[model samples]
Target: MIEIKDLHKSYKMGSNELHVLKGINFNVAEGELVAIMGSSGSGKSTLLNILGMLDEADAGSYTLDGIPIKNLNEKIAARYRNKFLGFIFQSFNLIGYKSALDNVAMPLYYQGVKRAERTEKAMHYLEKVGLANWSDHLPNELSGGQKQRVAIARALASEPKVLLADEPTGALDTKTSYEVMDLIQGINDEGKTILIVTHERDIANMTKRIVNLKDGIIIDDSKVEQVKASANV
Candidate 1:
């Protein structure tokens, strides 16, 4: 469902350039749960950003479900991003004042979904994430895991083709992190392509495959003997 070839990315710092990704190449198929593992400066986040269309690559190619993702105007890129990619961040980027239900509904509202339909869809996703009872709670009112669950619901509310999670379980405790991974594994079982960017070895083992990155290149790529997060939980 996703493909990249010879991807290269760099950032200029005054007279010097910091090369983030160099000759990266990989592919992800539908319903596959994959984790991109790397250390802090290994370029995992840069690769994820490019995959999510949040940033452009300096060279090479990226194809999301067969569409070339290069040189598109901002409007079209935004449209494609909204239509195909769903993002989950470590910071749980929810509005402080909004309730969980409303937060989940925000993306649909932006899509011009009517009030009734969006509310129904949002509630469905919230319930799917086991947060229906917490709908009226605000971010600050919920625990870290709860807030992350709300974020996951919000990401899924868009019904996008790919789910890109950046350090999704980074802030939660071990049990909570395993629980969240269980939820993500369940989602992948239902045929949605999921890509998680995490440095934790145990967390990466929860995914079906692990792609190790070092110095901006994929050092190892292989399917793993999936470890059940539910067992750990």
Candidate 2:
């Protein structure tokens, strides 16, 4: 579903170059749940941004589905991103004034989905996340778990092909972190390709496959068949 080849990105900070991604290579098949694992300053977030189409790789090829994206204009890239991607961030990114339901429906509104239909779908997603009763609550009205759930609902409401999450559980306590991961796993179970970027080993272990990075290049790739069994159990 997604492929990155020979990616290189760097930022000029004063007189020094802050190299972020260095010749990174990876591919995620359709419907797979995978994690990018790394330490601080290891470029996991940079890779996530490139994959999400929010940032460009200075030198590399990114192909989503089958289209090469290294040269897509900003407008075209944005359109493709909105049409096929769902994003969850550590900060939750919900507007303070908007209720969970309304926040979840924002993408649909951008897609020109009729108001009634979008509301119906958003509510259904909220209920799926066990937050139907809290639909009218703003982000501040919910607990950490609920806010993350609302974020998940917002991600899923658009029915995108891939879910890109960066430190999704970073703000939650241990129990709430597990809950959020479970919810993300449930979404992956229904055939969404999931790519998570995290520094936490435990969180990375939850994914079926993991790509460990250092200095931006993948140093190890391992398949955890045991995760499948554990998840089922």
Q: Which candidate is the best by TM-score?
A: 1
Model 2, span 113-197: residue lDDT tens: 9999999999999999999999999899999889989988898888988999989999988777877888787778888899988
lDDT of 1 by residue, 184-231 (tens): 999999999999999899999999999999999999999999999999
Candidate no. 1 TM-score: 0.98
Provide TM-scores for the models. Answer: 0.98, 0.95
In model 1, the Cα lDDT at residue 149 comes to 91
Return the clash pairs for model 1, or none.
none
lDDT of 1: 0.94
Residue 60 accuracy (lDDT) in model 1: 97
- Candidate 1 deviation (Cα RMSD): 0.8
TM-score, model 2 to reference: 0.95
Query: Which regions of candidate 1 are displaced past 4 Å?
Result: none
Task: Determine which window of 10 residues in candidate 1 has minimal summed lDDT.
Answer: 73-82
